[model samples]
Structure formats: C-alpha cells, structure tokens
Target: MAQVEIYDGEGDELLFTGQFDFLPRAGESIARNTDDYFHYYEVIDVWHREDSEAGRFQACLAVKIVD
Candidate 1:
C-alpha cells in the first residue's frame, strides 16, 4: 500500500489523506461523500516520494474541482 495526500488543484489546500493500493494518475477522477453532498475532483498532477522505510511510498495528488 502507498500513502497518498490529496490536495486542491488550484492551491495548497489539503483535501484528504489516506492509503491506497495504488497511486492515481493525472486525468483520473476521485469522489468523496460528506455529510450533505458528494464532491468530485479530477486528478491534475501527481508527485511521488520514496520513503526510507522499506516497501513504503508517499504521493501527493493535485485535483481540480469537478461537478
């Protein structure tokens, strides 16, 4: 599994952070549900980091707001 940090594509605001089996690429879309509504985002950029810990990696994904 890999750790992922999701951020708003327009700025530095962080949206979510979690672990995933694989990293998402640019042009992919991700959705999340909140208390009142569902939100969607389009992946715009992805940055990867190789951690010192064995078999562990971290990635940052920038996503644009999507309806």
Candidate 2:
C-alpha cells in the first residue's frame, strides 16, 4: 500500500488522505466510491516523495467531474 493524498485541482482544498492499495498516475481518473455518493476525479498532476521516516508516498492533484 501507498500513502496517498488527494487534493483539489485548484490546489486550494484537500479532498482525502490515507493509505490506498491502488496508485493512480497523472492523467488518470480516481473513483471515490462511497455509500452516499460516488464521484470521479480527473488526475491533473502527481508528485512522489520519499523520506527515511515516512517512506514513499504520493500526492495527487485532481478535479472533480460533475456528471
């Protein structure tokens, strides 16, 4: 698993942050499947970081698609 941080495409708001089994690349879409609602976000950019203590992680910037 990888530590993932999902942020709004505008880079102003953070949508989600947690460990996920799947890592999405830039230009891909992520599906946020919830009990109440399901949303798809378009991945605009992705950044990876590595630290001795934190290990490897990814931060993704995405925009929500209205459908």
> What 10-residue stretch in candidate 2 is worst by lDDT?
58-67
Candidate 1 local lDDT, 1-67, one digit each (tens):
8779998888879989978788889999888878888888899999976778777667899999898
Task: Give lDDT: candidate 1, residue 15.
Answer: 85
In terms of lDDT, model 2 sits at 0.70
> What are the lDDT scores of the predictions, listed in order?
0.86, 0.70
TM-score of each candidate? 0.76, 0.65
Model 1: lDDT equals 0.86
Off by over 4 Å in 1: 49-57
* TM-score of decoy 1: 0.76
Name the runs in model 2 displaced over 4 angstroms. 49-58
